[model samples]
Target: MAQLSDDCFAFGGPMMSVDDAVGLIAARVSAVQERESISLHEADGRILANDIAAPLPLPPFTNSAVDGYAVRGSDLPLQAEAVFPVTGRVQAGGSAQAPLQAGHAMRIFTGAPMPVGADTVFMQEDVRLDGNGRVVVPAGLRPGANVRPAGEDVAAGHPALKAGQRLRPQDVALLAAFGLPHVDVRRRIRVAVFSTGNELVSPGDRRGDAQLFDSNRFMLGALLARLGCEVSDLGIIGDDRAALAGSLEQVGRSHDLILTSGGVSTGEEDHVKAAVERAGTLVLWRMAIKPGRPVAMGIIGGTPLVGLPGNPVASFVTFVHVVRPTVLALSGAAQEPLLPMPLRAAFTYKKKIARREYVRVNLRQAPDGVLEATKFPREGAGLLSSLVDTDGLVELGEEVTRVELGQTVGFLSYASLM
Candidate 1:
C-alpha cells in the first residue's frame, strides 16, 4: 500500500474553496495499492494496469465492405462494353491469398477478402450476369470502391487503451477485438460507510417522535458501489460519542476509506469530527458553497475519512462533490468526463450576492432550437424532492450581480462528475 503522510490533517478552516479542500485532503496521499489480475468478466469497474496496443490490424487483410464483385480499375472501357470472366468466388471469410490477375473479375461478398490484384468492387445491383459466368461493369466506377483495406479500422502496434482507464462494456469489446479474454485490472478499494444520528431510523423500523429513516447510508453505498468500491456497511450510530468512535475505529481498521454522516458539526451529539481527529487528524471543516456548508475531512488510522452534514441533501451533495473524487483517486481511474454544457437562463431567481449558488432547474427546448433552463419551485437544501424533481443544476457565478431573463449562464448536469 502507498503510505500517506500523517500531517495531512493539520489544516483547519472556516470555509474553504472546493479545489483548496481537495488539495488539502490529497496533499499527503499517494496512489492506491496495486493488485493482481483477474479475468475480464470480473473486472468491470477495476482500473487498467498498463497501456494496451494492437498486436495486429483489426481485419488483418483487405476485404470487401459491401456485397459486390471485384474488378481491376482499367478492366472496363469507358464507352465500349467490356466483359470479364469470373475466375474465383470470395464470400465472407473466403481466401484470396494470391494476387488478382488482369482481365479477370472475382465474385466477392460482404466482409470477404479482396482478391490479389483486384482493386475495385462493383455492387451486384449495378451489374448483370449473362448465361456464361461473367460480370459486366458500368462506366464511372472508381478503383477500391466498397473495399475495406487492411489496418484501416485499427492499425497494428497502435495504442488501444491507456493506463489508468476504467473499463466499460464497450472497452471490453475493444479488448475482445484483440482476442484477449483476460485484461489486467486493479483490485477494488475497500470502503466502510455508516450514518450517525439519534433522530434517524432504519427504513422498516417504526418512526418514533420526529424520527426519519436513514437515506444517507443507501445513497452513499449506491454511489460507492457504482465506483466499484468494496463497501462494508457499518449501520447507524446514535448520539453517543463512544459508540460512534468504536464503530469508526472498527471500520477504519480494514478499509482504505471511511465515510459517515451526521455528528460532524458543532451539535452536542457531533462526534464524527472529534473521533476522526482523535483517530488521526481533521484536514478541513467547511466549504464556501451553498446548500452544503458543513463538509469535513480527516484521516482514521491510515484510511481517509469524510464527515458529511446531517441534512439528506447536504450529505448527498457533499458525497458527490468530495468523497467521489477521493474514491476515484484510490481506484486509479482516468480523469472524469466533461462537465455540463452551459445554457441560457430563462427565468429570474433571487439570491445573496456573495455566496455561490447551484439552483435545480428543468430544461426545455424552445422553438428557436435553443435549450433554456428554468428553476424549480422549491430550493431548500433539506428538501430531497427538489433534487429529485429538477433535471439539472443552474450554476450562478459568484461574480455575477444578478441574472437577466434572456442572459446566458453556466448549467451543470446532475449526472456530471468532472
Candidate 2:
C-alpha cells in the first residue's frame, strides 16, 4: 500500500461527493508491484502483470474453414456442371503432397492446411462425386470462399492480452492456444475483515437478547473473495479503543488492507474512528451518499483501512461502490466501470436534500416488452431483505429533486457488481 499524505483526508473540506471520493482514492492509491508465476488452471480472475503478445499467427497457416474441396478459383467451369479429376486428399495435420493443377480438385477436411496453389474451396455439400471418381463442380462460386487466410484471426507480434487484464475462461483458452502453460500475474491482495460492536455475535453462536449476529464480516469476506483477494476473518472486536487499536496494529503488519464494519460513525460506541486516528491517520470520512454515507478511509500502521456502515444494506452498497475499486487498484488491476443501464421508473420519488441515492428496485417487463423498475415498499438501511428481493439499484443524482413515474433512470444490476 502507498503512503497517503497525512492531509489526504482533509479533502479541501468535508462531505465529499461520490465521484470526487472515488477519483481521489483512485488517484492516490498505487498498485502493489509484487508478481508471481501461476499455471493457467489457477490464473482465473487474476490480473496480468505484463502484456502477452501472440508468438505466431492464430491459425499459424492458411487452412480450410469447412469440409470442402480445394481448387484454383479460375479452374471452375463457367457452365452449370463440370467434371474435375480428384488428384489427392488432405486432412488436418497433414501436408499437401503437390500443388493443385487447373481443372483438378483435392479432397480437404475442415481445419486442414490449404494445398499449394489452391485459392478457393467449395463445401462438399455443394459438389457431387461422379461415377468416374471426379467431382462435379457448380458455377458462381467466388474466390477465397470458405478459406481461413493465414493470420486472419490474429497476427504474429500483435498484443493478444494487455497488462492489468483480469483473465477469464476465454482468455485462458487464448493463452493455451499459444501453448503457454504459465502466466505472470499480480499476487492476490491480502485483506483482514472484522466487525466492531459489543452487541455483535458471530453466526452459529447463541446470541443474547440484546445482541445481533455479525453479518457484515461474512458479506465483506465473500465480496473480497470474489475480487480475488486473500481474506482473513478477524471476527468481531468490542468497542474498547485499546483492543481495537491493538488489532489494527497487529493486522496492519501482515495484511495489505484492513476492512471493518461499524464503529466509524459519531456514536458513543463507535471506537473505530478514534482507534484508527490514534493508530495512524483518517484520510476521509462521511461520503455524501444514501444507504452508505458514514464511510471512513485511511491508513493504519502502514496498511490501508476502510470502515463501512454497520447496516447490512449500507455495508454491501458501500463495499461495491468504494471498496471494490480500492481493492482492484491495490492489486494492480484495471479499474472496471460501473455504468448503469437506463430503465423506466415505475414509481415516483421526492428528495428535498441534495445527496446521491441508490434505491433498491425490482425489474419487471411490462406488457409492451419494456423493462420498468419498481421501488421496494420498505426503505431502511437495516432491512437486508430488501436487497434479497430486488434485482438491482436505481441511482438518483444529487440535483434531482423528484422522479416521476415512467421517467428514465439509471439502474445498476447486482450481477454486474457481485
Candidate 3:
C-alpha cells in the first residue's frame, strides 16, 4: 500500500468545490504500480497496464465482402451484361485455385481471398449462371465493388487498445482475434466499507423500535463491486470511539481504501472524524455540493478513507462524484471525463445558495422531438425513491441561481456512471 503525502489534502479553505476536490485528489493520489498478466477470459472489466498493438492487419488478405463473382473490371462488356466462363471457385478459408484469366469469372464466397488479377466483385444476386457453366456479369458494376481490402478494419502495428482502458466484451473479442491469450492488467483494488451508527442494523438482524436497516453499506458494497473492486464489508459499527478506531486501524493495514457512511458531519453523535484523526490523519472535511456536503476524506494506517453522508441519496451522489474517481485513480485507470447531455428543463428551479447542486430528474421526449427533464416531486436527500424513480441528475453550476422553464440544463444519466 502507498501512503499519500501529509499535505495531500491540506487545502486551507472552507468547503471545496467539486472541481477543486476532484483536481486535488487526482493530483495527490498515485496509481498502484502493481500489475499482473491474466488470461483474456478473466480480463473483462480489468484496466490495461500497457497499450495493445495490432500484430497483423485485421483481414491479413484481400477478401470478398459478400458472396460474389471475382472478375477483372476491364473485361466486362461496355454495352450490356455479357457471359463469361466460370474458371474457378473459392470458398472462405481456402485460397484461389489460380489467377483469373481475362474474360473469365470466378465464383467466390464471403471472406474468401480475392484471386490474383481480379480487382472487382459482383454480388451473386446481380448475376445469373447460364446452363453451360457461364456467368453473366452486369456492365454497370463498379470496380472493387463488394471487395474487402486488406487491413480495412485495423492496420498492422496500430494500437488496438490503450493503457488504462477497461476491457469490455468487444475488446476481448479483439484480443482474441489477434490470438493474444493473455493481457497485462492492473490488479484489483481492495476496499473496506462500513457504516457508523448505533441506530443502524443489518438487514438480517432483528430490529428494535428506533433501529433502521443499514442500507449504505450494501449500496456501497454493490457500487464498489461494479467498479471492479474487492470489497470487505466491516459491518455496522456503534458510536464507540475505541471500537471505531480499532476497526479502522485493523482494516487500514489490510485494504487499499476505507469507506464509511455516517458520523462525518458536525454533530454530537458523529465520531468517525475524531476516530480517523486519532488513528491517522483527516485530509478533507467538506465539499460545497448539494445532497452531499459533509464528505470526509483522510488516511488511516496509510490507507485512504472516504466518509460519506448518512442520507442514501447523498451517499450515492457523493460516491459517484468523489469516491468513484478516487477508486479509479488509485486502481491505475485513466480519469474519464463526465460529459452530460443538454436537455430542456420542464420545470422551474431556484436555489439561493452558491453551491453546486445535483437534482434528480426524469427525462421524457416531448411531442416536438425535444428531450425534457422533469424534477422528481420530492427533493430530500433521505428519499431513496427519488433515485429509483429518476433517470439521472441535472447538474447546476455554482453561480446559477434559477433555472427557467424550457432552459437547457446538463443532464447526466445514471447509466454513464455505471
Q: What TM-score goes with each of the models?
A: 0.92, 0.96, 0.98
Best candidate per TM-score, number?
Answer: 3
lDDT, model 2: 0.89
Candidate 3, TM-score vs. the true structure?
0.98
* Residue 84 displacement in candidate 1 (angstroms): 3.0
Superior by lDDT: candidate 1 or candidate 2 = 2
Pairs with backbone N, CA or C atoms under 3 Å apart (clashes), candidate 3: none
Least accurate stretch of 10 residues (summed lDDT) in model 2?
1-10
Q: What are the lDDT figures for the candidates, one per model?
A: 0.77, 0.89, 0.90
Candidate 1 vs candidate 2: the TM-score winner is 2
Per-residue C-alpha lDDT of model 3 across residues 345-406, encoded as one tens digit per residue: 99899985779999999999999999999999988999988988999999999999999999
As a whole number from 0 to 100, the lDDT of residue 171 in candidate 3 is 96
Off by over 4 Å in 1: 24-27, 76-82, 97-99, 350-354
Q: Residues 145-220, candidate 2, lDDT per residue (tens digit)?
A: 9999989988999999999998989999999988899999999989999999999999999999999999889989
lDDT (tens digit, per residue) of candidate 1 on 1-418: 3345566656755777666656654555555757667776886667887899998898888888888778887785577567878888878967875666898888889889888788789888988887699887778776678888999989999998988888888888878888888888877888888888888898999889899998889888988888888898888888876777677767777888888888877876687777776667676567766778887677666677888887777777677667877887777766463365778888887677656667778999978999999888776778888777888777765565678898887887777742
